[model samples]
Target chain A: MTTWMRLMSNDGRIVFGRVENSYLHEYESLHAPVPTGAVLSLRTLTPVAPCAPGKVVALWNNFHALAAKLEKPVPEHPLFLLKPAESVIGSQQPIRRPAHYAGKIVFEGELGIVIGKRCSNASLDEAEAAIFGYTIVNDVTAAGLLNENPHFPQWCRAKGFDTFCCIGPAIVSGFDWRSARVVTKLDGVERQNYPLDDMVFTPAQQVSLISRDMTLEPGDVIACGTSLGVGSIGDGATVEVSIDGIGALVNTLAVSSGEAEAAAAVEGAA
Target chain B: MTTWMRLMSNDGRIVFGRVENSYLHEYESLHAPVPTGAVLSLRTLTPVAPCAPGKVVALWNNFHALAAKLEKPVPEHPLFLLKPAESVIGSQQPIRRPAHYAGKIVFEGELGIVIGKRCSNASLDEAEAAIFGYTIVNDVTAAGLLNENPHFPQWCRAKGFDTFCCIGPAIVSGFDWRSARVVTKLDGVERQNYPLDDMVFTPAQQVSLISRDMTLEPGDVIACGTSLGVGSIGDGATVEVSIDGIGALVNTLAVSSGEAEAAAAVEGAA
Candidate 1:
């Protein structure tokens, strides 16, 4: 198994690298990475999301445990929504509260499947082959915005604010997700502990089924929806989503501020 | 007023140009385009979508006539969904039927707001300044897939098929949209004729309000939702979405084929 990460050097150069013990061996690019043989300490580099996905195809009610609890039947196909690229943020980034929304903000810990090849209407084999690696995703949402109007469910707007989709630490290739478990902690207290084997649709099945609806491109992410433990996070509270094979992704909710000032803060950080 | 278009030359060179009467004046780029002094006949170039957007922020029930007809209240804020970039197709491109879904495909003729400046939580004045131009759009949908499940509404999936979001002909700058009308023709028969002035939210209001939800990047598109007549299209039927200032965007629905084969054909064309 190999682990890959994207990071910024102290000089502000973005580079992809293969993670080793305590160092990152640099690479030229993520698609066809070539080793530069220059190793850097992990402590000296600032980590970013492993990949820049064009869109994040996130599933809903895909876990058997979550479905049973919510009284929802197992869906025949993957029920999903598209999160915009603007919602993405790296681990250790702040999950800012939207300026206009003063409602509760929730965090869902999920396993993200990273696409390595462009695919549409792919077969089971092709779908499995298209799977590049796996990463951790904190699908943060403005809980109140969803179902605010009885006529329409605002899925995209509720979950698509800046820094709402947190992904990182590393993308692990050939990780055994079937035997792994996702553990989420809020303020260092365990809130969610679920097994990945309980997923109704496997990662390959998700890719194959969803490809029939829309094309999945290279670097596009499919967040395999969360299970069991989803709860609200208060301002300045820290949330960490971790998997055994993949590393932990930690982020803190920023203090609520006016909409314009919050937007400017995020832009300034970008 | 100026009109801009992106096209493929006979030699397969992609260029952005200013549209004149039956000719194109080449430019260096879409953002900060500098005239290249190369003129080409319109007949020699193949037109593509005016701009490649990272995400298409689409509004729902934003038209006053549509809400009044359906007996739904005018939403306080823009009720919207995100259309993936993969779903975008330029004018003249074929709208292929999804392989897995054998259902009614509907066409929605609407106006599109193209953003030139990056903005989030912008003021109304800032929003107006950020608007780059306007174009015509056919927000196509798989009518049956929507509300397929009683619990979850598949807005993104039903409306996000490959080639579902058809845009362009040209992006018109400084066009008078308030006095214009969106006229949609189905196989030479007029089906929709809605005045742009009936919109519940103006273009600037849309930009400013949506900016609070997520950042609008340059080339990002906000498809103003359709009104009045939205109907299904049969195989090989032509659909044209036209505005007075923005030229007509014409497309044809391709005959249904196997999902894998259809996807392969699209990839082959790409």
Candidate 2:
């Protein structure tokens, strides 16, 4: 398995490269591995989200373990949601809570399939080939927003805020994801630990089925739905979503004081 | 009301301009009007979607009339869903049916709020200032996908196909939306006729509240949810969504042959 990452180097140059033994071997492109002969220490660079996605298509209940645990029937097709591209953040970015929303925020750890090619109406084999790599995703949600009104669940609003989606560490290719497991930790305490083998739909099947619904372009991400052990996070708590082969994505949660104050001032004026 | 539109001129150039008296006055940017001294006949240009949005935040039950009609309670907050940017299409673009989905597709005609600036945690007045203009939206949905699996409603999948969202004709600024009405017709037969004043939340309130949920960027669209008379569209049927101030957005629905054949072949092979 090879690890790919986008990072800002010591010289302030943003580059895409491969990580090997804590050193980065800069590459010209992810599609064609033409080495740029620029090797730098990984510690000398600041990591960013591996790829800039145009859109993130996230799943809701594509896990067998979660379905059985919830006593819900397995879905015939993937139940998915769209997380706006603006919500995306890198590994170390803080998950800023909405100023107007004071509610329980939860972290969902799942594997993200990064599309490498423009895929439309692709067959199973073709879909398999279209997958470039996998990365860790922290699909943070304002849990209280889901049942606040009861008339309708605000899936997009509950999850679409800026910095709600924390993804990265690195995108790893050629990894055997079937054996991988998602282990989530909050404040250094283990919470969710689920196996990828318990998925209702395989990665290839998901790619093929979803591609039929919409075109999946290069850098587009498909977040495989999370399993059980999902729980809430308090302000100032550090959450880390880890996968064995992919690596760990760590982010801190906090309420924005400046924005909150600005909102309150506006409210008072009105 | 001031109308803004993007059109392809007879000289084979796509230009963003002000639409006045069946003539196009070309402008460099949407924020400021810097006339390029190029005025072309409106008939010489093909009209496109008014603005290029990064994301379209669409509402579900923000209409009082429809909620009351459906026997549902009014939402405390705007219950919204996201339509991926890839789903967006200009007026007159055909709504291509998903190859794998052989189901009912319905159209929800509503007013679209276009954002002018990057706004978050804005007050009512700030939100009002952030609104650039209004347009018409045909929020098309794959109706059958909603309840095919009873566990979770596939809102994103139901509406996330390419060309599912038809928006445009023009973005009319400084329009009196309170007296405005959305009139939808299928095959030239009137179907839905609803008043914008029947909305649970006003445009400014929706902007203020939704901005608190997430940052509304320039050119971002928030579809003010639809009212009653949402129904299905037959294959090869022409559907139109019209607002009184903004022009009508018309599109045709058709089944995709090549993609469907490819999917069927894969199914047969499996």
What is every candidate's alpha-carbon RMSD to the true fold?
4.9, 4.7
Local distance difference test, per candidate?
0.93, 0.88
Candidate 1 lDDT over residue span A209-252, tens digit each: 99999999988999999999999999889999999989899999
Q: Ignoring the other chain, what TM-score does chain B have in each prediction? A: 0.93, 0.92
Model 1 lDDT per residue over B1-270, tens place: 899999998888888889989899998876667899999898999999999999999899999999999999999999998889989999999999998888999999999999989999999999999998999999999999988987789999999988999999899999899999999999999999999999999999999999999999988999999999999999889999999888899999987666557779899999
Docking class of 1: medium
Alpha-carbon runs more than 4 Å astray in model 2: A9-14, A21-44, A255-270, B9-13, B31-44, B258-270
- DockQ, prediction 1: 0.80
Q: Every model's DockQ, to 2 decimals?
A: 0.80, 0.65
Per-residue accuracy of model 2 over B87-179 as CA lDDT, tens digit each: 899898889988778789999999999998889989999999999999999999999887787767778888889898889989999999999
TM-score of each: 0.94, 0.91
